[model samples]
Target chain A: MPPPLKAVLADDEKSLCVHLKNLLQQAWPELQICAEARNGVEALEMIEKHHPDIAFLDIKMPGMSGMEVARRAADMCRIVFITAYDQFAVQAFENEAVDYLLKPVEPERLARTIQRLKERFEKRDLDPAPIQAVLKSLQGRLAAAAPPPYLKWIKVPDRQSLRLIAVEEICCFQAQDKYTVVQTEREEFLIRKPIKELVDELDPQTFWQIHRSTIVNAAWIDKISTSLTGSYVLTLKRRPGTFTVSRGYRDRFKSM
Target chain B: MMKTGNKLQTPCDSVRQKDFKPMSPTLRQHRKGLSWKDLGLTALFSTIIAALLTYVFQDESFWVYLIISQGIGLSICTLCRYSLALFNPQTSWGIVAVVATASIFGGMLGGTVGAWLSGIEMPIFLSKKIYTLRVLIMSLLFGSVIAYYFFSRERLSEIRGLLQEERIQRLTSEKHAVQSQLKMLQAQIEPHFLFNTLSNILSLLDSDAARGKTMLRDLTRYLRASLAESRSQWSTLGSEMELVGAYLNIFKIRMDERLQVHIEMDEALKEIPFSPMLIQPLVENAVIHGLDATIEGGTIHIRAEQENGLLRITVADTGQGIASVPSPGLGLANIRERLQALYGGRGRLIITENQPRGVKAVIEVPYATAP
Candidate 1:
């Protein structure tokens, strides 16, 4: 049998890193884990020092991002990125032909990535062209996937025709059973969905999650008020009045 | 004209009466319409006119001198009122005109009394001279008054036009600010959502490819809804809940038995409108900030009710609660700002600890039946 392929695992979560190392050993008994790193900077140093044939990188790290390390260590070894965030940066990984594993990494997916890496290594002339194409496709998909950032109006079903709702006129949203009720200064409507799914499509920075199921538009929070019960609540400048801040979310008021 | 004047006077008098009814210490300083600088200027002008009249009539009898003094005082008073009309057009001109006329009449009576007291015979020529001086003074006073009126009126119109222009500029800037914020919000939501969904897809590819395929279809639907409503300020409650359900379904696949969601809402509130994507972020926070930190997983509860004329929505989670790090996060901050912009002071959001050990958020908005 050919000599074991040497590798290093780099991730912030100690347990996850250990688990991945164990899986690598089990899957390819010949693969040896040369080193382990908790962050991107350490991963880079370890990769440079040991010069492992493969490196597993976690996308988010304390000091450096996984992409930066991958870019720098491109010539040294094969790269596999592990991420909790998948969609936004898929194209980035695709462009480099770097393998990526979404967190909580599964054994089957990890094995497939390893298999692909082994095949490329054996060929020696692994063209990055396919990866580049994938990246281009991902970019196109992303562009075509969502509405343009400048959208100003949303259409909701009214009596028979669609009613146009101006974004600036909405007040807040309330979750109903299997639906989300939208409250504006003028009217209300029931949409067929839950709150969690909508968040992926909405901007997190603009619409804040103040509670477990309540998201408020940042523009609407007039001032944060303290209640008689020693809890904090948000007072909006709009038509409807005060909203209470659950004790769990009180930490959000430390900056206020 | 009289009726109009009476109507105007009633409001003005009412305002003036209200202003003068109580002399609160805090409001005392602002009571006087004329500033110290204006009073000082008026006094200075009166003194100058008095001195000039005294010098011009030094050789004449006291009676003639008094008449000349009256003429000069009247002329000076007219100048002061005319100057005021030119400089400060917004204030009532009636008061200034009355004061100038009173001063002229007072000077004439004083001069006549002084002349009679001095016992100087008034020459017929002196009367002619007085009349000529009065004519000249009146002509000069009226001429300046008319000229000042038109000049100030023209200037006032120009200033009013400028103020209107400035107001338009301010409104435009405010609109731009709102639009930019909307754009930033759009950028933030899409990427974060996409990233999370893609991660889920990746995880599902191994064990349940069929489920993964369904998730993809759901994702496409979710994306389309998001894109369609991305720029909208508000959406129907029903639509928002649909989006939330889609998110839960996706998470249910990944979280399995660890995640549970319960929603409670009144049926009558189905048509209520609210900001788009409002509830989703809160649900997301429950997952990412609360449940994600724990291994045991948790349950999220959403409740909505109408109180008084307002709709109140609440989201509760049974998890580790908020992190002790004390950061509101960009997502929360954005929600607050958006609420403020949309509802001014009418909408509100609150976050608190749940009964057992989780986080609960409440959102309150005015209830309107139709758009």
Candidate 2:
């Protein structure tokens, strides 16, 4: 009775775009594929020209991504993300209140997405609250997805040859006078890096700030025992000395 | 030590003082045997009270009457304190009840004994009303004072214990929350590149089966190696190289021969330990930013060597060199952060221009062998 639902499909892969278009044609006979874009840039232009009712977009494209296209053309049409990410990674979309179809789109899953879109069109209800929430959640996920810098290796100076130490091998670091003493299971080395700076660089989960002068590897810790005076003593599995956990840093061992 | 004249006297009924010392429940119920200190303190206090009463009564045996009265009063006060301590009663009502009962009982017993000891022939109740009332008032004062002291002492200690327990509980929960949050963040590894590569492989499967199979094999190898290496915090240099090899295989499938990688690792350093997922990011950066930009693909040369007490790694690509020192992106920034965390100031990353063209990234860390 109503005019056919018009939609735009965008994907960098021509094969995938064609495949999705065929699937859509088979699932909903009344639907019209008004535009097909090979990339995000093309998709944006097509949306501006056609002003379609729905846009199916691949999340990652060559120059721009589906998320970017959604942001620019959000007011014009409803957006559905196409992604290759696993279910765990795609949980971000659920939080954003956005609809997403996983890669190698199945008929059953596509039908569900179509059903929801059809209901929204029939009701003529376009609420911006969920779209706003999705945008905020998308920003958060992007920030989290941005990988932070981490240490790869350490250069330790030995007697004759300069030794390369893996950061993970060092069991603990103790600050002495002006230098930090880096200890592994077998030997100890001195470095100019202060305990304070090392604390910032090391992974907080693996290397705990147990004492003011000591940053210990959680894996290397043998056991933590409370002394008669209520102070905590941390013993390392492969090392000789027992480190004293100061009152201020005792909270790190609160679970123990 | 009963006196000859006091033999005919109604034997002074002295209540046993129950002491509340920290002990096992079984031991707590059994009172500690009277000690020499207890006897001496009681004797001294009784003597003092007797001397004062003698001045007031002006009787021949006024000292004996005061001694009996003082002894009974001290015993009742001590008993009340012990009962209240054992029960751990919080209400003011409990204290009031203990004091009221102890005072009444002590007043009657002590007044009767003191009157008989003072050689009063008649019953004390039948004697002068003022004398009996004075004895009762004296007993009440001593009993209440000692009972009140014990009650307040217990209340103060209980409050202190509660405050200490509350502090420990709050700190423990806060630490647990922080540790779990760190774990959650660490577990969420960004798999953006991985999924994209997978999608490419899926498209290639139907179009070019042979290439898809090769890419799938490489992807499997990469996943297996990476997953195994990530289980532990450390990995060998040999294993890290293999992981890079696997990663390059997947990238080569997408880029074809456009991405050429040549790796030179010192045979001696193969046995040396390295952190997992370290140098791979640098190689990735070289490919994505450097080689991807050039018209024709460029070669990435990766070399590692042991210098004077330090290990040096260099990744150079033959692509268009940057005009200026550009700000570090996610990959370079990640490497910098990781290096800073591992070696503090000792760990260094130096970026420079290659001889002909492209950018060269050098990483240096202390050379230490695995135990």
Candidate 3:
């Protein structure tokens, strides 16, 4: 009755996703198998499309890591991070009371996790605040190890040849399934770089993340208006579509 | 009086025993004993003194003056050698006493002997001139001057020897610290790598048993090669390549079909004894920074060539490209340091950007020079 209790799985490795999916069916047979994503961009898209009750996120993946996706997902779904083995990730998850599954996930462990998820959703007392805290701390730990390098130029595959696009020319970035559409004032081009990656690479002061899938250049904004739903919607100076600023990121907009 | 010299005998015996063993045949005449070499040197030195005294007095023969000078010289020289044993070198008063006793005693012995040989008779003692308080006091002054010179020179040289020893000790410890630092760097087989490989092995065992067995074999070889190599200064180029091969093979399984490796090395060059960790870190850098950073992954090409009295080994990768790769400071710096240490300036590590994509690292070391 209640949407058949859906869940989404995400990992770069196809076999790993399949393996986890098979194990998940044994643990929660009643749960509907909605979708599986091979990368962080696809994972975020699946979460948005399905509005699933849970997401099994692999912490390490190219383009966008599971932690980055989790940061953008906010309160969208309950997160159960899967890591091969990261000491800092393990400690952060434990301290934050966020669930994490080590690789080679045993059936018994999966059953326990499924049971906990069912109980939490049934009670509906689970909050997204600790997930936010855990992810922030993990980011800090990762940055301390090696600061994320700023990207100045990105290579975009063109129709017949390749084009090197400078970061300054880009007005906004919007996620399109697995690829990101890089919008410049002159023209819009598509790139395989997910929105999550641009968040790390682009200068945070100029390019602001207004949506899980959209990041807009601050100088190119038409205006930010508060919708009747009390959420901020931003439109670019030359760009057409209005980008919704989710509640998780609205604080950055409201203060400005 | 002479029996008491036995107590003062030990310290001098211990010190001089190690040096000039022939001269110190015995302290049998600690009061006035000398080896023939000592006697000849003493006779020559005393003659110089006797000439001076005879020139001043102008009354006695140089022979009579020589006997007195010889008595004082031999007595003071032999006794001063053993003198410090009875007294602390730290005390001035103790030293004056040693000098006074030896000089005056010798003056009396030689004066009395010379007076007897020359057939002079006296009321209570022979040669009142030699026994005069003036002569005894002068003997004490001259003995003190000579004693100060001897001790000062000895002390200066002892201090110099200590300073030399200290310098050698400091240099040895500095060498030790560098050695330990190298050992620690060598033992840096990343735990994350080990755990990740093991985790993959566990997963594969359940789903793909055949691949699991292959990974296990590769892992075993990797562990053994690394463990054996780190403990030794050098390993054969072939074994090191085997170690690198095992390492990449494990990574291949873990990365799925993403990783590709091509190793080109001459069979003749494989027997060359190369520094243990030189090429391994460069390969690791290629895998982690050059290849692992990209989702599509890439290829690692390792080639070793021997030519013109030099061995050149290069590890080039095509994954993220050189522009995308950040400077991997520690691993590369470590390799350079090792190269410098093992081959001095003869060894070299050169890094360049690989065309199309990735990074190329080359190591050059003299083939004829090895550990």
lDDT of 1 by residue, A1-256 (tens): 7677788888755545656776777787778899998767889999999999888887665445566677677678877778876665665676656688877677898789888988977887555454344445555543443334432333456565444344454556668877787666557877765677665655665566666666666665655644334566675543456667676666756665
Please name the candidate that would achieve the greatest lDDT relative to the true structure. Answer: 3
lDDT of 2: 0.67
Among residues 3 or more apart in sequence or in different chains, the pairs in candidate 3 whose N, CA or C atoms overlap within 3 Å are: B321-B358
- TM-score (chain A) of candidate 2? 0.56
Q: Report the C-alpha lDDT of model 1 over B57-148, residue by residue, as the tens digit.
A: 46554345444444444444444455443443222343345445544554455444434545545464348676446434533443344346
Ten-residue stretch with the least lDDT total in model 3 chain B: B22-31
For residues B1-371, write the lDDT of model 2, one tens digit per residue: 11232222122212111221111111112133344754565456555656666677765476665656665655654556455445433345655676677667766676566566566655544577866656665665556554565467557765864464444334433333333223323432446566666766776776677877887888888777665655454677878888788778777765665778788998889978876666776777677666754446679898989999898888888876543223334245455555655565688776666657776778888888962
Q: How far off is model 3, as Cα RMSD?
A: 25.2
In model 2, the runs with Cα more than 4 Å from the true position are A1-7, A11-39, A49-53, A60-65, A84-98, A118-133, A136-256, B1-204, B231-236, B251-273, B283-311, B316-347, B351-360, B366-371
TM-score of the second chain for every model: 0.55, 0.46, 0.52
Clashes of 1: 91
User: Model 2 Cα displacement at A215 (Å)?
Assistant: 25
Write model 2 residue lDDT over A1-256, tens digit each, in one string: 9888899999765656766787799899899999998667889999999989999998766446777788888889888889877564367668755778887777899999999889989998666566556666668665653434444345566654345455666788889999999997666889888999888877787788877898888867655655435577777753576777898898866764
Best by TM-score: 3
Real contacts recovered, all predictions: 0.04, 0.08, 0.11
In order of listing, the candidates' clash counts read 91, 27, 1
Q: What is the C-alpha local distance difference test score of each model?
A: 0.61, 0.67, 0.70
Candidate 3 lDDT, tens digit per residue, B228-333? 5665666789888998999999878766677899999988877788767677777887887667656777899999998898899989889665444434332555
